[model samples]
Target: MTVVVNHHGVSAADVLTVARESATVSLSVDAIAAMTKSRSIVDSIERDGRPVYGISTGFGALANTFISPERRAELQHALIRSHAAGIGAPMPREVVRAMILLRIRSLALAHSGVRHIIVQALVDLLNHDITPWVPEHGSLGASGDLAPLAHCALVLMGEGWVLGKDGHRINGGDALMAAGLTPIELSSKEGLALINGTDGMLGMLILANDDLAHLCTMADVTAALSIEAMLGTDRPFHPSIHAIRPHPGQGLSAANIFRLLQNSAIMDSHRDDFEHAVQDAYSMRCAPQVAGAARDTLDFARGVAARELVSVADNPVVLPDGRVESTGNFHGAPLGFAADFLAIAACEIGSISERRVDRLLDVTRSRSLPPFLTPDAGVNSGLMIAQYTAAGIVAENRRLASPASVDTIPTSGMQEDHVSMGWAAAVKLRRVLDNLTSLLAVELLAAVRGLQLRAPLQPSPAGRIATEFVSLFAGRPGPDVFLAPILEHARATISGRDLRQALEAEVGPLA
Candidate 1:
């Protein structure tokens, strides 16, 4: 099925399909007509001898300089070639696809004044699986994502390189020619229109932000299961307890934990066990406060990113009344701040999970579970090393959690005085994800080990399903056996599985 770009409204789910799943893309017919009409106004303005930024004159620090009509096309081509200076390792193919889809959506708004054929060529490239080789670095995300997107514009002119379906780099001109596609000659304002937008940073932020939302929900569910396995108290998540100070996230988290352990016979049986006290440690008791704050932070970031998705975010917007106006919409501070918030949220997930893992390894804190949860503690240091790994990852996450938005460096000889460093924000989001995934994996493995010792008294219905999922790859792990496979299985369990769907299938929609 063809995914339509409606310009005014685009969903996070659609971005996922086009970016990660290679969904086909096309522009709405009305949007195409709108772009044509907008470009006609731009033409009329140019024909009337009116001055406009990046149209009749130069750009950035050189904005005051005028361009002769004879050098117009050469100027457009030169802008792309000279700005295609992105360096470092290539971005993943999925990110490149996302950049293409987002740019097409922005142009479809008709305010960028790009020609219809330029947008059509981008659509054709998406349809034919001809993705440009965009590097991951070199974008300060102010004055737009200039360098990386210039590489995207380079592919439109068939000037740079692209990866074919066969996974080999070939000249973009040859690749387009082989596929019966002609190179596009960029018109006035078309080169700047294509590259001067926040699509690249927005694409990465949207996907990463969505994933972090899911991770927050999953973190709560997984933490509940870990609490049960470790024989911790349920009083901390009680409705009355949360209702008193009711932060929305804290209340929602309390409800989630209560629901996750609703049908547990073990928890019911332990209510009167005075040895297990009314209160557990902070890691178990404060799960709601810690995880909920992360959830609230993600909610804020999602709102910021969604607003950015529909914004024009281009330099020199073309007006409907035949005028060009240079503006600062291309600056990426909004996206940069949102991405930094998401990175901090993800790091907190790892931080809290590391605490739980530490508790599980401590014999005194772990209730009645064996040391390191191993049958033969002396000979097999089972899961002893796992705690060390969790600590290391938590340290790395702390380093990554340092906000990229707080830092800025000037570019373009101080003309582009303040940069967003948003590419750093985007790249750091990926690192935070990796650290959180590994941290959660370690927590799940340790939780399952703790649960095995509590047999005969089963876990709650939600916990039962999670226990069964882990049991598929690891069954009450004994001493002197390889633990690598079990750790990998635990990673798969939490990495991309739809935890909310799994919960809904067992219990109803979370209230």
Candidate 2:
């Protein structure tokens, strides 16, 4: 698949294809024409010898310093090399790819005053599967993700490190040579244009938004299974119950649970029994409310990402009338807030899931099920420590939930005072979502075992299919064995999407 880059902006799906699927990228003829037109204005400005913030002068606190025309190329080169100061481990290939794609998208909009070949060079990197080695730090999220993007721009100059298509790290110049490509020299305004944007944070946001949406449905599925395993009522999931208040996410989640539990013999068997509690505990009864709010929050984040997708996060944007004006579009407060908000939402989902896993383990709380769902009782520890693992992750997620956007520190000689810290928020949000995936996997493991303990009483059709799918990786439920590998397999199942796909096949699409 080839994603055509245009000034009209790309969709989140298009970004994912280029980022994850290794889909090649191409610049539209119109995008190239737009770049040519914008570059002329920059050239004209350079010849007139008027000091432009990015064209003829140094950046940030150094903006006051002016450079002669002969030295402008060196200035752009120095900007990329010096700004390439990110620290810590290299970012994943997909993230670097997404950042490159988004940067191209921004430049292709013709507001960044970069040449068409600059956009084409980035396109070549993506097409050839040459991913730059971008370290995870060095952006205040106010002056854009400068350090990270600079690392990427360094690759365009053939002077950084990159992972080749074969997944081996190589010198940037060597990688370019191997791909039969030539590096371009940075020109006036081009280096600043490359590094100045919120592409890194925005890319992470779009990826997390997609992952969390899928997890929301997966949460509903697991919540239903947990309800059946615990002998809880499904009354709370009724469509009418959610209709009165009617948040869109709430209705969708309730409908999913309601359908997942339909034709469930376990639920039907308990319907008439007065012994069964009239109501379930909060974890089971209020599953939709917690998961629903997370879904709603994800929707809000998606909206923010959508708006940012088309925005020009650059300084000194070139106008249609050929005016280059500095603007605050590079600020990352919006992306930072969205990423932080999502961390809280994802953390809450894991928090409630931990509660459900706890209930399935405790003898006093799990009703008729064996302690920790182990038939041998004290002879086998069962899933006791599994609950402990979930608890640890939940605690960690709670700490990660603290908003990174609220904190700020000055950078660039205090010229960039009151930093957004959005890059920090984005990085932490990735951790929270990953933890949520593990947390959900743990819940699925316990709930599947609990359902098996229910035995002769059949689960809902969807639940039975889920049990079978997890069983392939986890093996038949029995006395405790070497559990780490089993748990890893179960995590793979949740992350792999096979379980959800199988259930949806049985019950149709979830919300």
Model 1: which residue pairs collide? none
Off-target runs (Cα >4 Å) in candidate 1 are 7-9, 164-168, 498-500
Of the candidates shown, which would achieve the greatest TM-score relative to the real structure?
A: 2
lDDT of 1: 0.82
Candidate 2 lDDT over residue span 1-511, tens digit each: 9999998879999989988899999999999998899999999998899889999999998989998999999999999999999888888898999999999999999998898999999999999889999988888898899999999999899999997656666899998999999999989999999999999999999989988998899889889999988988878888999999888888899899989999988888888777675878999989999899988998899999999998988998999898999989888999999999999999998999999999999889888888888889788899889889999999999999999999998877888887788888999998998898898899999999988888899999988998898788776668788878878887787777788888888898998
lDDT score, residue 304, model 2?
A: 99
lDDT for each residue of candidate 1 in 1-511, tens digit (9 for 90 to 100): 6789865746777788988888998888888899999889778867876778888788788877888877777888999998899877777788888888888888988898888889999989889888888877879888878888898889889889886666667798887887799899977888888889888888898888767766777788778888998888888888999889878888888888878878787788777888664778888889989888877887787888888778888879987776678789988888888888888878887898889988887788888777888877898887898889899989998899898878888877678899898878988888898778888888888887777767888888887787777778888758656778877877777776665677768977663
Candidate 2: deviation at residue 22, Å? 0.6
lDDT of each structure? 0.82, 0.90
